[model samples]
Target: MTPMIPMIPTSTTIPLLDAMLADPARAQAPLGDGPARARTGVAVASFIDGLRCFDAGPTAMIARVEALAPEAQLFAWEGVGLAAEARGQIDVALAAAPTFAPLLLVGAGWADALRGRKIGAPRCAHVDRWSVLDGQGFCLGLLDRRAALLEFAPEPTVALAIDQGIGRSLYFVHGGTASAIERAIMDVPASRRGALWSGVGLASVITNGLNDTARADLRERGGADLQLGEHLAALLLARISTPPHEPPTGWAATVLDGSEPPIAVLRRGLDRG
Candidate 1:
């Protein structure tokens, strides 16, 4: 059995996020962010608010994300937003999607396969041009060496197609309408949502809410990656569901809550059944 990994201290990750939020250069960034960029920005900000550290609200954080959109890759922005916001939206998106869209989180090895033409380039290219929440064809983009690919279609067919693929992947069969996916993401719980945003693999660390054991387990099952950190700065400022200015205590408070790092207390409070 694998020995459980200790939880990463907030101290190790908080400063990195703090610096991203404070950089003055992000102030005058995105000149004319389109819908995809705007939605991606909102998703990014929602995760930041879930962190409970920086006080920037959706309005301000969205503006900031828009400014930075031009300087950064769109997937770099979307990946972060999805990492933090997927948790809130996943259940609902799955429920609301008209067809199941398989969202694939690929590893560096798989990305290389695509670039080298080892595996055929996605049949549907530049899927990112369509919203993961609304598009019909797959949205393909890089998260570092990894690639996040999505195709809205029947789950059984998509799953079978992927199962026969040349590389490894972790995926979700999301169902629901495009608008539903968007709305559900907006409804994600503010505090613990940080924890839920923890994606399936190495990228899980980007949120700093899940312990190593959980992340590792996810990796073993082919569910995570390393690209989650791309939006750490924006996620820190995403909106919170808790009442304004009232810091949550107990497990209600996540490590992202810099004002009150309550995971320890919350963990201690849970009955060790």
Candidate 2:
């Protein structure tokens, strides 16, 4: 069994992050664009590292992300927002990025518990409902931030629990190999597949706009690739008969660990789950 890892406090992280980013060599080091599966991990870690000591509180987190390069900024913002939301600071999360508002509005049944009231989950058509690049066709030659986001968005999976693990895992699959991924997922025991897919979908939204190669690929493949990706994502979501309700497992609560650092919690969740 995977031992439960406690969340690391930011008080412990902020100083370490400060030291790393302050180093001229380390700060200037190239940030490589890794594979889709590892993309979220890289972005979440980078967000935590990029944050400075002076940038305290949730609002500062958002501001810090804004200073990063466009690709990094989008992923960092999503990471900050989702992590903050898990910690019960919905207001802070939304302020981090207005686009994040939809994440909370989605079938987040857990929100009621956080808000201390029973609120109905809104009908969310696409997990990326709040993405700024929706409905826009991304041409291969014109792969910008918007194109990258659309290109790299993960295909939806079933929800075994209401958390980010499944979503994070989905990021591992290259967009072109989505059909093979679906087949492999179907091979998992029927009982566990929902949780697996749900985690992937959750991570998809958080790390939506982080890929650089996907952008280059779009520039190379042209609009057909973009449309194909959207179609595949839709098809995958359709396979998930489960409604977008929060998973009964206490995944989000663990994710929403208010007292601990979101990066540490997510890293452990990805590794152990």
Candidate 3:
């Protein structure tokens, strides 16, 4: 069994948590009910914690992040990358290497490419670093939807990553209205929508508790690719040290019945020495 991730210590995390809790609306994502609400809140807090704790050093940051619930630590790691980039401390974190392998793994997997440029390895068993770009896309979509929606870009990989991020933010930022989210997606360039759909799949199953009608509508709009996205996110949840908070009424209920993902697979890509 995965160990429990305790609440972060007060010196570094409490103020950050309090500030984030106070401004929950700033991100515009509704805090739903039950497991989904709690999990979503945890991700936000962990992200905020990541931003706050980074200055203390990677070792300090890792200790605090590990204190969070195991299922939500990935976002905390993502926050650390955001903090490192904002502070120009990328190299500092990367050099920590095997000692900070978990953060490096998530950072490489779920961070933006600018950060990836600094980290030579992802430290994953089978995971790739593509989602790092997707993380940037989420920020753009949530903070600047116009730019995110209108990217006909030179690099398809980066463009798709942005598209996926926008799709993810759309699920949270838009009111839980399927038609509105669907329309926003449909309004974007067609080639980009698939990536967006994948991000939506990530949000729906990963956080859970999107209303049934809205969830069904989005899935219908997504067509064949939606399930692919959902399954991948489910598999990712399996990689967490703990079970994801996916609920029966939520979209991932059916897929999670099989098996937990093997996170140890991540170690094969790294050299502890």
Worst 10 residues of 1 by lDDT: 166-175
User: Could you arrange the candidates by lDDT from highest to lowest?
Assistant: 3, 2, 1
Ranking by TM-score: 3, 2, 1
Q: Which stretches of candidate 1 lie over 4 Å from their true place?
A: 1-63, 66-76, 79-199, 202-208, 221-273
Better of 2 and 3 by TM-score: 3
Q: How would you encode candidate 2's per-residue C-alpha lDDT over 1-273 as one tens digit per residue? A: 322212333422233233444452442232223345355445545544433311346545546665666546533443343334334444544544444343222312222222322111212223342221111111110112222222233233212222123223333433323343345445544544443343334444345653556544532432332332333234333332134434224433443322332223344554565
TM-score of 2: 0.36
Clashes of each: 25, 15, 5
Tens digit per residue, CA lDDT, model 3, 1-273? 322222333332233324443574543354323324455666666676666666566566677777877656666676666555444445555554233333433443333333323222232232434444455556556655766676434155346545666677777666444566777888876777776777777777766746677577778888655665676676665544343353433333323322222111221212231
RMSD (CA, Å), candidate 1 to true, equals 19.4
What TM-score does each of the candidates earn?
A: 0.20, 0.36, 0.62
- Kindly indicate the candidate among 1 and 3 with the higher TM-score: 3
**Global lDDT of each candidate:** 0.27, 0.35, 0.54
Higher-scoring candidate on lDDT, 2 or 3: 3
lDDT of 1 by residue, 180-241 (tens): 22232234333212222222111222223334554344434332111222122223223221
What 10-residue stretch in candidate 3 is worst by lDDT? 261-270
Model 2 CA lDDT for position 256: 32
